[model samples]
Target: SQSSVDNMSCPSTPSTPTSPIPYEIQIATEDDRESILNFLQTFFFRDEPLNSYLGIITEETPRCLDLENFSLKELNNGVNLKAVYNGKIIGVSLNGILERGWLGKDDPYKHGDTKFGIILDLLERVARESDPFKKYPDCEKAMTVKILSVDGTYRGKGIAKALMAKTRELAKEHGCGFMSVDCTSHFTACALKNLGFELHYSLKYVDHKVNGEVVLNPAPPHVAVTVYTQKID
Candidate 1:
């Protein structure tokens, strides 16, 4: 799933060009933590649909510690990757391994009243209902993209796609049988679809409610949270 607004690019496969895109996809390690966090603050924290709708980062509160923690919790995982151009991080894919009963095992939400917690609660619901593990019985484990985002200035140039492509390779190396992403934005869904991921589940904002109140009311086009998966052959 994407927590970044740059998914608006929804790029197609890169065509032959006069020169290369000037970026390289590389494994992200603990050393890159600060840079990745800075990149995310600029590219992801403010405009992602849920963050925007919930006002997770606002003028009064410029940062959300919980969200920051959630984003970086798996940063050191060998599967996480970043796209760097001119020595600057332009995109990142924070991935983690999920074993066969992950849905029923992990608790993704703890601070239910906090905006970040609320967002995680919704995602947990989506995962529980989708149950990707059950759908792909042969997949003993899978690599899940927790956060996928790209710098706005570098989008529409296939940076996000390149990051995902690299993530797929990393998944295979880690022995994952499948890979999945939850698309929190329509643009992200379109991007994943272009990369051949199958939509396994979706929940429209209008249909999700809390105490009879619709919790999310993002602008048009980002109307649903969707789960997409691809077997790693």
Candidate 2:
């Protein structure tokens, strides 16, 4: 299945699916920051559902620093993973460690009125209301998948699944008790569900409004924002 919001930043036309290539999953390091950023810019920024819905990136404005910073904020956390094919980075799972009582600890208005700020606000609301920490109380820390993306040509080839599986392993090694992912894209939600992540919370876009106007109206097959989580065993 295609696991990303927009075929994981795939080109408009996808390549044939029969050729399965060998790829290695490895931890992304500091030196790989620029490569990861460049990969995300090419494959993730333009096609992510919310970014597409809000026109966050356009011909005039090709980059949104807010989102880019958000994606890279936890790169040095040692939980991020990348899939490489012939030395080319084709997939990424940017993850972060979430401690208990992490909610309400930051200034929600830090991004302030920007489109990416709106997204952060929505995710914050989910994290607060769902309170995954509360659900998995025995554990004081959890590993959260902040971003999951794959090259479009590699879609339906299990790249995303591999990335997520590696993330789960990393969570166990990092002493986390659970793994959580806030999925804004339907495809990602479905993929995680198939991998045994349970639905913790869900908020429909229509219900999330600002000034009575629905701010994000993603296309069909992408409806609500959801949080899916699984315990680390």
Candidate 3:
């Protein structure tokens, strides 16, 4: 039942069902940026399919720069969600609102390098072409789940599923008609699908042509960028 959304891709993870863990969800504040980014450095950059292909977490690279830039950009001056357990931040969903035609135009901020630029370009294209809000042209608001990261210590405890559940409520608070995510992690797309997010479009890495070549040759099961969405209630 796992399906791709649009462009952001994720590597499929082997299902390991586990009981849900206890945690509390809340909207994030500016002060929490440092802690959330730190957690992502350990889990996302090292594990995110596209980031790994771009050498984002390589020792030779500046620490957390790529991850921070990508995730933080979606902050949109704040409206993020976090999962706390015993006073520690175990998960995050960096969010933003995508107005109609937001993707039909160019991104003002230029990506740092060819690697980043190419990936962003690919995703942007699909987002505009296969916009989840296309059918509901009057639906001006689309809540964007820009980045979702969970702590390694909390993995397999259903932390991600819990966070996504809260995200729905948060989207409603933001007055969004639907929630959207460009899931680059394969497991994430599958999990969202299970949570009832509909897969809209997908672009496989091998098929994403760059000068007629497949530059992002990520490892197995990390095949394509998937976009998923669901109406918020």
TM-score of each candidate structure, all chains considered together: 0.90, 0.89, 0.85
Better of 1 and 3 by TM-score: 1
Q: Between the candidate structures 2 and 3, which one is better when assessed by TM-score?
A: 2
Candidate 2 local lDDT, 1-233, one digit each (tens): 22333233312223555567899999998889899999999998888898899888899999888788778876777889999999999999999998998887865346748888878878777887888987887999899998899998888788998999999998998899999999888878878877888878787877788888888889967778888889988
Tens-place lDDT digits, model 3, residues 55-135: 767877747554467677655355688899888888888888778777656666456365666667677766866788885
- Write down the TM-score for model 1: 0.90
Ranking by TM-score: 1, 2, 3
Clashes (candidate 3): 13
lDDT against true structure, model 3: 0.74
Winner by TM-score: 1
Q: Residue 53 of candidate 2: its Cα lDDT? A: 91
Better of 1 and 2 by TM-score: 1
lDDT of 3 at 92: 86
Off by over 4 Å in 1: 1-19, 106-109
Model 2, position 121: C-alpha lDDT score: 75
For candidate 2, the 10 contiguous residues with the lowest summed lDDT are 5-14
Worst 10 residues of 1 by lDDT: 1-10
Candidate 2 matches the true fold with a TM-score of: 0.89
